[model samples]
Target: MGKLIVHPDYQGNGIGTALLKEIEKDNSGLRQELFTSDQSLRNLRLYKRLGFVQFKIKPLSKDLNLVFMEKKPGLLEI
Candidate 1:
């Protein structure tokens, strides 16, 4: 698991892509997972493009939706 944060000024600069690729390359035998709110449509699209798929969706509050996503390199499912 990892957390990546990008400043508004750094958006669309590929920083997040670089970090995600590096982490995926360095980790083996373990699937990666992350969560985001429904509001982050850009992030949601980016994550899906990287092969992460939504496994769960839970409500955290009346105005917020939590989406749990996961990615696996092999046949193993989590």
Candidate 2:
């Protein structure tokens, strides 16, 4: 899966979680991965909450970094 962005007006609803769950359902039994900016704390939290773990951190610049995260197959089913 790629980037996931829920509209700010709809923030705090279960949109992001639901979207991730759907992706998980579609790709059942397959490993999933994604990356997001280190500064995006909310995104990081959401991904972690859904069973993704940080596997890498690549620095883009002094103030920016990419956090790569992944979830193993059958790890956490919604």
Candidate maximizing TM-score: 2
**Model 2, which residues run further than 4 Å from truth?**
none
**Residue-wise C-alpha lDDT for candidate 2, range 1-78, written one tens digit per residue:** 446789999978999999999998899989999999999999999999999999999999999999999999968633
Number of the predicted model whose lDDT against the real structure is largest: 2
Worst 10 residues of 1 by lDDT: 69-78
Query: After best superposition, candidate 2 residue 24: deviation in angstroms?
Result: 0.4
- For each predicted model, how many residue pairs clash, with residues at least 3 apart or on different chains? 0, 0
CA lDDT, every prediction? Answer: 0.84, 0.91
The predictions' CA RMSDs to the true structure, in order, are 3.5, 1.6
